[model samples]
Target: MLPKKVKKRASLLAITLLVTVIGIFFILKSLNKNILYFKSPTDIKNNQNINFDKKIRVGGMVKKDSLIIKEEEIKFIITDFNNEINISFSGTVPNLFSEEKGVVAEGKLQDKTFFIADRILAKHDENYMPPELKDIMKKNAK
Candidate 1:
């Protein structure tokens, strides 16, 4: 038979370990819910399971001639050559945003073909220079 003091200490240690494990589980679950993963148009097409409620980012090149603006809202398509997803946004986009440019739209997926974006992020290459900077450089050269 184990001594009473040793038995008490062992039970306490077991309880502490269980509590720590449960706390860790909750933290990991919360992180899993909050983390937003970037997916390409082709990934969205090939993946069979997609969480519609969770916000996700779809990144790809803007399909040429797929941009449509109406008042404050804009609609465009993102394609990865193999597949494409339609993105709809209702806010002002960055000046760098245009057709045939790389873009990442953060929002929720309404379906396999349609996505409703809360934000649009335009991507530019390292060589990209802002218009103001370009003008300044040209003036300096003159």
Candidate 2:
């Protein structure tokens, strides 16, 4: 019973709504699969609501005197001053994976603060000083 102009407008609005709904659905689907949560040692220790099976990224300073490199597996401790988490990785480590450096481990948490890492990333400061050393220096300066 509507006029031609009103009918056309209704059709266009329906198509627009359908396209918007489909776009939103796909966007949410992709985000659910690709999103990863980042956690610090303190966060994991203080928060008990974290899911153990979810893949996550943990970042902190590699503990000095805690690195043990075997033929294939490497074990170390990551600390965020307030807490420390033990990590184990069985693969090639970055060239900068050494004592006193900033490292990020990607894996899933096993126990409360234990992470079974599948990949490890190491980063250094601008002066090539290890991140661990930089952290110590900053603390001393303060």
Candidate 3:
């Protein structure tokens, strides 16, 4: 038979462990739902069975000369230096979006080669300059 104090301590320990485990489980579950995986065009091409139902992010450079702006829609291609995927967005894009710049588009893939973007994110470094501006700078410097 265990002493009353010992029995109380054991119960407390067990409750603490159970609570901690439940907390961890809930945290992990929430994180799993919120996490959006980033993939490249090549990855999508290689993995044909990737989940298309869940929202995802695709990151790569915008392919040059692949942008077409219509009255209400914009279409472009994202490339990972190996493969390219066509992306279409019907809303306004970020001001920094341009060809040859790094971009991350969040949405679901319509098919293996096409993506419908819900959001478009353009990322650049602190010292980043647009390619056209950079070219002009180089010519001026020369």
* Model 2: lDDT of residue 61: 92
Q: Provide the TM-score for each candidate, comma-separated.
A: 0.64, 0.62, 0.66
| Cα lDDT of model 1 by residue, 12-92, tens digit | 999999999999999988897346457888788888899899889998899999999999889999998889999999998
Per-residue lDDT of candidate 3, residues 1-142 (tens digit): 9999999999999999999999999998889735645788887888857888978899899999999999988999999889999999988788889998889999988898999998999977569668999899989999
Worst 10 residues of 2 by lDDT: 31-40
Model 1 ranges with Cα > 4 A deviation: 1-37, 129-142
- Compare candidates 1 and 2 on lDDT and give the better one: 1
> Could you give the C-alpha RMSD of every candidate to the true structure, in order shown?
8.1, 7.6, 6.9
Maximum-lDDT candidate? 1
Backbone clash pairs for candidate 3 read: none
The best candidate in terms of TM-score = 3
